[model samples]
Target: MTTTRAHGEAARDDGRSAGRPSGRMLASYAAGSVGTGAFSTLPGLVLAYYLTDSIGVAAAVATVLVLVPKVIDVLAYPLIGALSDRASHRTGYRTG
Candidate 1:
């Protein structure tokens, strides 16, 4: 059960090559996730607060206004990505 290693990849007794990410990658990924989470979250929070405080919109109404599009996006994006991938495969263009 020997595994071939890619060039410049360090081999390990654990059977994973350096091509597999290590702790640095995990830290980088964690940082990126935190940044993405904050990036995605702040706009909705600000919009909702603005609607309630500045626009005189009711809090419940503002909450729903802010929430529904996110709900729709959550529901629709997977189907859209699947369709996009299917179209790209049919056209034989991986990057499309």
Candidate 2:
């Protein structure tokens, strides 16, 4: 049996062209993930420790402050996608 490379896809050792990742795609994903993680996780970790040890704020209040922002992410993602869809842009690119 034999396989062949398809257009745009990279040819692999098996002779079939497997999908290749675009550098922009990877970079965008990496940047977004880092930003989101920093926004959501870093504050929670830092504030929780600060409130529990240094500030003397109640644990419950500290937990709520750290958590509510993260919970809002559930709605924020779809809202952002909806906004993006409605937005008019000069540049267009393939999603997949």
Candidate 3:
């Protein structure tokens, strides 16, 4: 007799339950999200405050200074990733 497995049966062969992350994994993910949130938000807030209150920059100018880099980052990171991928392909990094 022969049998065929369905969608998630392969996962059980490795002792994992399909479609469900573990409690510890969930907690870790939550912590990572909190850390990522702080890192992404605090710098902008701190920079704007520093530029306006400490350095006496106008609010509008401070806003622009804080935001322009973020805009550049949003556009540049994907382009950089594409370039890195192309370079890696040319270099044959993992084609052994």
Candidate 4:
């Protein structure tokens, strides 16, 4: 014989009690995204201009300076992904 459970009971059986985010959690996540997006994007947009115009750096040099960090980020991401995968395998949690 088969038995059926309510929606909440079925979610709890799999250990994810809070199946969907609460309103407060969703609001907090939205606020965090706005703040983090502004902080991350503003510098990339302004840094090269500031270096070339205000600091009197040559345009080519400023471009290279701005680009080097991006290159490092490209290289580092794969390594970080691999590390996270390994950690997840060991701990059963996908956290670095």
Task: Choose the strongest candidate by lDDT.
Answer: 1
- Taking the tens digit of each residue's C-alpha lDDT, what string does model 1 give over 39-63? 9989999999899999999999998
Off by over 4 Å in 4: 1-38
lDDT of 4: 0.78
Error of 1 at 27 (Å): 8.7
> Candidate 3, residues 18-59: lDDT per residue as tens digits?
656678878998999999989998999998999999999999
Reference-based TM-score of each model: 0.58, 0.54, 0.54, 0.59
Show where candidate 2 strays beyond 4 Å.
Answer: 1-24, 88-96
- Where does candidate 2 clash, by residue pair? none
lDDT for position 16 in model 3: 50
Q: Which regions of candidate 1 deviate over 4 angstroms?
A: 1-34, 93-96
lDDT of 2 by residue, 1-96 (tens): 543567655544644344566677689999999998888687679989999889898999998988888788887989997777666353453353
lDDT at 46, model 3 = 95
Q: Count the backbone clashes (under 3 Å) in each candidate.
A: 0, 0, 0, 0
Query: Candidates sorted by lDDT, descending order?
Result: 1, 3, 4, 2
Task: Report the Cα lDDT for residue 75, model 2.
Answer: 74
Ten residues in sequence with the least summed lDDT for candidate 1: 10-19
Q: Tell me the lDDT of model 3 at 75.
A: 100
